[model samples]
Target: MADRWYPMGVPSFSRLAHEVPEPGMLVAHDRALYRVIVVHEDHPANWAEKDRNRLVQNRRAVEERKRHRARPLPREVFYPSPLDGWDGSEETWPNRPRGVELQPMAGGKRLHAGWPHPGWAYWYPVDEHHPVCASCGEPFPCREVDAAKEAARQMVKVEKLMAVGPSCCWHCGEPITSRQGARTFPGENLLLPGGPSPSFHQRKTGGCLYAAKEYEKKWREANPDLAETADLFGPADA
Candidate 1:
């Protein structure tokens, strides 16, 4: 597929191969002989398990013989969101009404609710100045004042969501939205454990947002009572 080519000066390669620069054409490489352009594979040498095993086996010999080293995986590779803590058994979110249930956004889509760093909305400070419409209290179709108030309310919800003690990205204030969006820890920070280590006890890296979901998956996989939970929480409206 990549073998096709277009000339630099002329639009077509076939015509440019022989055309000379008079008013338009320019003579380039000779067209009499065929030249082969080799394309090598760009996959990393240690991409596969077998390649990794071979590399490990040859490590001592390679080091002793001073052979070139294979490139290592980038230290800054993205990590998935860490799992949520408490299994939905405890109340951690603050300034929330009782029995308020906020479902995680769809497509593993992380909402911009602020993580460790304060966001533009934070400086604005949502309050009564931006009150919900007296006519309608629901989220949308409100004035700028109401929108800012809603953003504040949502930010509160987000804080409550994370107060359960989930590990969050430093840049974004919300839960690590996408594992692919996560960056490497820049330095020692509050989110890490004992310095550079991840907080695994409270959260599982790359796991679901709610611990209840994980529990349900495991329970259903092991037991035959998956159908019985229909009356418990019912289907997610998400």
Candidate 2:
């Protein structure tokens, strides 16, 4: 059976950039100037739940843009404390691994792949011993088991931190400090250096929200052509 289409689902950005537009296709309502990357007729979601997630993410992006515009820029005097150790530089902080590149198999099927979550170890019982490698699926001796487990733990931690996305100071593009493998910044409600983190809602607003708003204004001014369409208008219905 073929997949069904819906309006407002997240369109693939990469595809949109490369492909030429076809006739009879409608430009995305969220931002009319930008054409839809993947037509709903072609890249439909597998289920309503997937559709809902895309809708929510797109909505959040709009809200964030609004908040970004309304908020003020970071003040020149505002240097995140040295004690906090987040210098706010992008050169120092790198984007996380792209994870597994997923594509549909058929009928809008999702492929199960991507970087594993960082908190995998916290879920495993350290006291109990398993001989088989959970990640690589290789057999190791009891002595090697701990080593493999530690390696697994390390990969998760590293990927998680990298997952936080670019490490530049959200304000000045200064390199940020990732102390003890923890990606720390000096602001609140801060759009994470990456997408939402596992501990997202739990994070205190720490003034990052204000910093983001300021940063948005600076960026928009720098790039006058980048339309603030979605920022001004909420995501639209089909």
Candidate 3:
């Protein structure tokens, strides 16, 4: 005989949502962009309870994302990170390990991924009032006129100093002395003779400012057997 027992409580399909993995999807909720790591798919009837319950579900992800401005992605991961072009409002799919790709559904022009925040460890904040835009000569904090100020930064010879600051090195947290002006000439090359390549943010900024070449020459004089690692980004354990 076939069973005839009816389920007492009906299930609601609308309540179900995709279950994402670690370092979950970056998305906007409550009119703010954030990384959402979990979802509580209880019945629509139970939304009032679940809405609050979701706070517990997403507490860690919210905390991790709030650490945003303070914790910048390193140059290594930054280079190939699919998150490179990611703006916060759209979805950033976490397909790659420790990284994300901008969601295709959000088909508008992207904003600069919030420049990595310089936490206490690496960068000291730079401040300039009425700083001229390196590109258009407009005043900076120029969100309305031209966004993605990458060009402006480069025009100012921010070169690597653009990584995280007013005018300083990200590696050592020191200011870039002898800037000579508010901006350096475009195409200027400020690099130490024998340090990490300009491909490295440290090499371009502190490598030149800190007299690393002199120190390197002396260090090489002292010891000459340590081989430079091919991958400055670090070893690939996986």
Candidate 4:
């Protein structure tokens, strides 16, 4: 005789009549594979009980999901501090600004508490009237400091440009004459000595073009700082 199959009772298929097979019969239903220990009458009461248990399981699953779902933290909570492991003592944080205190937070985490905010280690106001920069925690309108920083950056760039040797063909290492056809690198005005572009190949001969290209590739690999600046300026014209 051919093997027969029967589905177990579930809430969706409860209305369908299910026939109970003999004991030790193999049953596969709802992803569950089991052998029947004993045969029982297929009754509506048994299906109703199973349905009640399934409903309870579904309610429990929903509640579990809700419990684990992330919710917005309060403004006071801010975010995890870099000093999360620091002990709640001023001596530990010697650099901790005046009026800031080490405050104990939830989950045994400690944070640097400043006026009007918590959990931010660097944020503090100069006074009640002046707002602070979110990053540096300095007073607003820090133009002087910003200008000084920019000047310093420019000075570094100038120094790097000055470090590059005089205008010459990268391939030949020969000094580029004024009469030669030249290709200008990015920031050539600052980079080349006396403000002249490097001569790669003479337009008449074009002999050094391929070698210049290969040499430039290696040069760019060696000088990453100038390579980034070169990318910003894009390909130079002949």
Best by lDDT: 4
All candidates: CA RMSD (Å): 30.2, 25.9, 22.1, 29.6
Per-residue lDDT for 1-238 in model 1, tens only? 1122112212233321111112111112211111112212223432455544533544444353344534323541343111112122112311111111111212242222211121211111112223233565422223444456568877876565445435653323345544433323222333322344122222334443244344445445554554355554433422
Candidate 1 lowest-lDDT run of ten: 93-102
Model 4 Cα shift for residue 108 (angstroms):
48
Worst 10 residues of 2 by lDDT: 119-128
lDDT of 2: 0.33
Q: Which stretches of candidate 4 lie over 4 Å from their true place?
A: 1-141, 166-194, 198-238
Give all TM-scores, in the order shown. 0.15, 0.17, 0.17, 0.22
Better of 3 and 4 by TM-score: 4
Candidate 4 residues 58-154, lDDT tens each? 4554455457854533641664332334443333421232222232211243223222122222221112243434666434323444556568877
Q: Tens digits of per-residue lDDT for model 3 on 89-166?
A: 212422211212232223443322211111111111122232444765433333333334445645554544445444
Ordered list by TM-score, greatest first: 4, 3, 2, 1
Full-model lDDT for every candidate: 0.31, 0.33, 0.33, 0.41
Tell how far residue 201 is off in model 3, in angstroms. 20
Candidate 1 residue pairs that clash: 20-25, 21-25, 80-179, 93-160, 114-173, 114-174, 115-172, 115-173, 115-174
Candidate 3 Cα lDDT to native:
0.33
